[model samples]
Target: MEKTFKNLEIYKVKKAESVQEFYENLSLNRPGLTIPSLDTLYDVGHFNVFTRGNCGSTGPVSYNRKDYYKISLVIGEGILFYPDQQIVVDGPALLLTNPDVPYHWQAGSEAQSGYFCLFTENFIRNRNETLRETLFSRIKDHPVIHLSDAQATVFSEIFKKMMAEMDGEYIHKFDLLRNYIHLLTHEAVKICPVNEASKPTNASARLASQFIDLLERQFPIDSTDRVVELKTAHDFAAKLSVHVNHLNHAVKEVTGKTTSDHISRRIANEAIALLRYTEWNISEIGYCLGFEYPANFNIFFKKQTQSTPKAFRKV
Candidate 1:
């Protein structure tokens, strides 16, 4: 799986954060930071836990995906922005996010505190198949479960146990940690069961949902060498093995937007994010976003936002 990730053209787009990059970003954002045995996290099947502040401030983040699975226990208030909706987590909450979902976390206040642990798929692979599917599958909605005080205490104690185990010298400690992760998932299931009821029921809704998922999978274009592969309605229709007209009708029926409209809007959003947050030159950004010419990207950006990419970036 790791080899597939490295070789896949889609993965080269750098839409998702790798574990190494996650720490590197930490070091860059928080100077003089020190985390013990950082080198060990590079290995496959790695797992680690940290207190919220120890990880870093829960500041606003660009909407993006992670290559690893993460479970966060958030106390106090914060806002989670997914592409489709915004969720305000107002109290103690258990948040689960997988590799397939892109989201942004915006801190509400300094009062927020809790624990979060992240691990690669290999970390729990082959050990418990049921637990793996239960926790890491695509969580469509309700990924954040608001917890009562007693429930929060129960999860808090589990995280405390994980922290204690990490500090201890017990051999096979990770095995125990994996069990804790499993326990956490089971406990969360008790609060909110993962079910298919959240999925779209009708045909048009399903096709539209699939189209949106496929579109979202290609986003936050972080690398200059890679470009979005599915750019046109025909491209998406072919990939989904449907007629272009059929796909277009379904999407319009369900989303109230044309196929080209969704594509262009998403591409424009990525263009803005790259222009705002990245240091890449205009041409590099253009090429990565599937515009072969810098002039073309400028035109598209202007058409979408009524401002040239250069001028937008300056502002």
Candidate 2:
């Protein structure tokens, strides 16, 4: 049954498409779709916005990730598919996507109209690291935000501003565009502020909090030059100046998950993201994840996800 799943449609994987490849496929699929010069796009770090005309579908889009981030003002109903869940939206909505997640959008009706913008991370770098981190962190956790008519109008106006800025030839247009991107992200946060569970007060909770923060600081794995260093409970325990058993007790007591469980889950998430978004071979990905042997990575991934990295990247 596991072997059969390799050929199953639901288990099939599509590698994330790059900006150039996205436009190439768009042109091939939607003939006569005029776009700005690709050269200009790269020179400006690749940013573009579009108004969805006549519903915006060459056909049903498949489940896949893109190499860029996207923010969309969805005006109609649709279903969004994640790895383990799906969300249905029946009205105006805001959709946020990052390079870390693979998803598919299926329209619920024929009448769909909205605006969306796609841009590389570097395009939005305004020296505000906090803003950049907040943007992608919120996007990865909550990709869909249902919108009210008033809120929809606000996002729509923002998109219009982005479109207008894109068409202009100002000397510092990219900087202006970055500001608009920040505006959209900040507005989204305002509309749907993530509710925080109260802060940790006890010593165990505080220690667990520190462990989680330290673990998360090594994430997303943007490049292969650096690899995850602390993989085992002992490693993290040593770093935190606690015994492995004590660390485990604190984390399990506070987060209801063992130190190993938290580490494994985070590493698994990064592995999946790297597998779906990168062209690196299975061995290289394994090495980047701190596996000295390909077989170890395969076993770990299979234990976490019930699928091999190669099998996960079917395409």
Candidate 3:
């Protein structure tokens, strides 16, 4: 079963009673800055801004373990970020993030120089369905981009326009802002290097895409459940409401892997990542991957990689 975005908690910040209160609250929990209703801009929902003084800082700022998707446009001094890799954004750069990924930033001390727009998954879905897929699938996979002089000028103009509209007294200023945001996202996508040829366009390809999407939702598949639930081609085929042969054919045609093969490989890959990245014990790790018995998980792990889970964890 695919998990819906609604299940994920969304946070926004609105009213701070006082600047000190806001900074104190944000330094403790950054998500408060974007989660709606906790502040005054509840009507705007899932969108908020933080200037220099709002979160008073004279030097670089670091936010550890904060989970949210943000688009930051640096207008003056650049910011340095260290996530899984090191990234630096000097002038007029856009930074995208999600909760699954962690990041910290070092900002320069200056006047109200840069702008950050934080949005939720709902905001992305409401704006454009495909935008979420494209962004989540590609943005972080590539390197940070620094806009050219011409691109920077265009982005600066758009930012200025948005600020003006946000400050305007017009009744439909938010609607206008929404359109400007769309334009901004479209421009960002234009620079991203997505492998268009790899994108599925045909009906079979669409089905395959949906299948992968569904598979990811049931993620962290445990070793025990792996043998019971999606163990056979017919099991997944039935869940997908397609004939076993057809499912197998589509899976092979689109991804060049059989249904069972894909499942096994995904489970193996996730096990390796967890072994390398986390300190969870073998039994706990087995439970996380859906295995009821540690012994069974060890057998499967050894069969796949010719190494015990402990040995694999060490390597």
Candidate 4:
């Protein structure tokens, strides 16, 4: 069957002849994925406030998945759940969810109010280089933020000002919105708590973070580089300037997995992406994923995915 966003409860806002037309055409019944073309969809905009309603569904809501990034300021009670985490917003809080991951929410019955702004990812990404990571990373696992009353007041005022600007005939209203978004991002990150447990101050946590950073930097691990560095836990430990045991301890302490587990998971994640997204042959994909021999790659892939690379790719 052909994929459609209507199958999934997703709404795409296309540029309309008038604001009334824009709102009237908003339909939240789509499925699969929607990629917004800047020319056709960028002009549609809304400054909406919702109070006391369920989030409508219990599935992942992806912002960038359908070509937009959604920014929501929670003014009431709700809980957003991702696969591995949950964020409870009981008061004024600003949350940003990227389209890369799926998210869902369950709002309380006692009147949940919030301001929502939807815009194309390109529209926001063009304004700042770091926004891709800041806005879209899996960091929403750490999304619930505690804002002081004063800070919340400031955010409210800014939202009101942006709403007013949208109503005005300013030539640079879009530019102003861009700046306002940047400000909002800064404020959200400032109020959000650091994932200290995830990034421990202890010797082990420090080592694990460094190891993870290094591992991530060496993504799409080609066969050539794999032959040189990170072929084993000991190799990774030496690079991190720590003993293998210490490195393993750190990784296990922070991630509940050994150094080898992290390495295997990283390799597996890359392999899955390659299998699903690219048409590379299994052997070539294995080579690119750092296996000297296709057989070795096959075994590793099977161990991690419970199926051969080809089988997993088919699914």
Candidate 1 residues lying further than 4 Å off, grouped into runs, are 1-14, 28-32, 35-43, 54-61, 127-132, 135-140, 201-315
Writing each residue's lDDT as its tens digit, candidate 2 over 11-95 gives: 3245677788877876774688776666533223478888865443434346776768888888877677765566788899988
CA lDDT scores, all candidates in order: 0.74, 0.74, 0.55, 0.58
Model 3 stretches astray by more than 4 angstroms: 1-44, 50-62, 65-67, 76-79, 108-112, 127-131, 134-143, 196-212, 215-315
lDDT (Cα, tens digit) per residue for candidate 3, span 169-267:
999876676676677667776877565323555766666666666665555433433432454567677888888888778776655456776566456
lDDT value, residue 286 of candidate 1: 87
As for TM-score, the candidate ahead, 2 or 3, is 2
On residues 96-154, what C-alpha lDDT tens digit does candidate 4 reach at each position?
65443345555543565556666554345431132334433434445455566788787
TM-scores, all candidates, are 0.57, 0.59, 0.46, 0.46
Worst 10 residues of 2 by lDDT: 1-10
Can you list the residue pairs that collide in candidate 2? none
lDDT digits (tens) for residues 123-215 of candidate 1: 664411322234545343567888999999999999999999998999989999989988888788778866743777689889988998798
Best by TM-score: 2
Give the clash count for each candidate: 0, 0, 16, 14
lDDT of candidate 1 at residue 170, scale 0 to 100: 99
On a 0 to 100 scale, what is the lDDT of residue 220 in model 3? 46
After TM-score superposition, the amount by which residue 235's alpha carbon in candidate 3 deviates from its true location, in angstroms, is 11
